[model samples]
Target: MPYIEVIHPDEAEGRLRRIYDRVTGPGGQVDNVLQIHSLRPHTLEGHMALYKSVLHHPRNDLPKWFLEAIGVLVSLLNDCSYCARHHAAGMKRQMSGDTEKYEGCLEQLHRDHPGEPFSDAEQAALEYARKLTIAPGFVVVADLTPMREAGYGDGEIFEVNQVAAYFAYANRTVTGLGVHTEGEALGLFPPDGEEWRHG
Candidate 1:
């Protein structure tokens, strides 16, 4: 159980209901994270706004799916179960609801080191996120070359790095707050063609 009780949309005030509608009305449901945030509706609104601005920025070339994959990888590397499960559920959604691929990626490092088995690009991004997460002080211009060679420009690379960093922030917040799910949802990535439970 979450340290704070989750608030259902119907149970929310008008302000939070608006946030819930915006988040869910694109044929998607409000996720558990937001539900937890509903405990403080105004803060949820601000957080969602920032998240949407970053996610839907017009110049971003990397698909949301790939960004989410990075989120999962970073969360797992950090050993944050709450974040890991959250991003795993999102990646599971991207894998077209395939459990095998979803679970398999969970075990893979996704970074290319010597003898590492991942795409050159995936490796680059993974290495970047890991370094940023584990040792933010050590990142340099040289660290970005591989990603550039793999076709990411400065904006995408910055976005990728920021997303990785933000997820770490998210991990700390959710974990520190003792956020949890009711076990009704299997992972962050709910299976396709299945209804994701609402608050």
Candidate 2:
């Protein structure tokens, strides 16, 4: 379950069918997050496009692991465990399956004691993500000072901004619509390419 009816990959047809084919994970499965957009397939297209570009694009100069950590932290702050758990698994893999290291990282995030494994600049980004997630209206340019002081340029800061913002949108969608990870293939990364590789 989902709160709303979702078209299963096997049962999908036409445009929905095509989209599902491209986004399927293990065993031709579509995550509930993606399938929930079935009735309006184009939005699914937009969502996946944004997801790929934001989290998996080649142009993102930030380390993919760091971006995944940002996603996990932002999702946790929003109380969106569905997204958090998924991203945590991905982050663990990105860190080379270092379970001890991964758990320590997560503990730091949960306790807001960011350090070790994460550089000072990374900690600043995480702090910025917390503010943006919990109080977006109150965030100001002054906030970027710490991140810059920690060594992030404006563009790298923007990557932090985008990843945090994207997770906020995604977390809300999951929480609002009651999406779950019951059958999701955890930790699957977005495909890399100029365009989706059609299957």
Candidate 3:
């Protein structure tokens, strides 16, 4: 149960109803994270827009699965089971055809150790995420050297940073609000063929 009342999709009106429709079109279900912002529907709208732009934008330099991996890592570092479990499921869905890789990634995250299963770039990115999430003040320009060497340009680096930073905010929101997963998770794949529109 959530700390506050969440507006169910079926009972939403106006903007909230429209956003819920987009999130649960063709029989999809609304996750608790979105419901947390139900009291302020515009915030929910903003949240979804930022999420899609960061993780689902077509021009994103990093793969969706990799971004999801970062989300899981940050959530775990924060000890946020809600975000971790949800993103882990999303990561699993992204790697659906290759169960081995998905399981390997989860195991690596669980151990808090980056090993052979992940590429050098992924390792570097994960390290950056760990430091940023746990100690943002300690993050210096030199911290990005490995990522640059791993072939990530300035824009890609920014994207990774933003994703990690966003999740930190999201994880805190879920934790502070005592939000529960309630057996509801967002879909692993993008909705509406990759083009998200605002109402």
Best by TM-score: 2
Residue pairs with colliding backbones in model 1 are 89-188, 89-189, 90-189, 112-123
Tell me how far the alpha carbon of residue 163 in candidate 2 is from the true structure, in angstroms, after superposition.
0.6
**Compared with the true structure, what per-residue lDDT tens digits does model 2 show for residues 34-134?**
88899899999998888888888988899888899999999989999999998998888788887888888888878664787788999999999899999
Task: Give the alpha-carbon lDDT of every model.
Answer: 0.66, 0.86, 0.81
**lDDT accuracy of residue 113 in candidate 1:** 36
Residue lDDT tens for model 1, 1-199: 6777778767777777777776563334566667778867887766665555444444567766667777877777676777777666766666677676556555674433311334677668777887888888999989999889987778878888878877887777677677765443533332222222222
| Model 1 TM | 0.75
Which run of 10 residues does model 2 get worst, by summed lDDT?
Answer: 190-199
> Alpha carbon lDDT of residue 155, candidate 2?
92
Residue 13, candidate 1: Cα error in Å is 1.8
Itemize residue pairs with steric clashes in candidate 3.
none
* Runs of candidate 3 exceeding 4 Å displacement: 25-28, 185-187, 192-199
CA lDDT, candidate 3, residue 7: 87
Q: Candidate 3: deviation at residue 53, Å?
A: 0.9
Candidate 3 achieves a global lDDT of 0.81
Clashes of each: 4, 0, 0
Off by over 4 Å in 1: 5-10, 24-30, 55-59, 97-104, 110-117, 184-199
Q: For residue 2, give model 2's deviation from the true position in Å.
A: 1.4
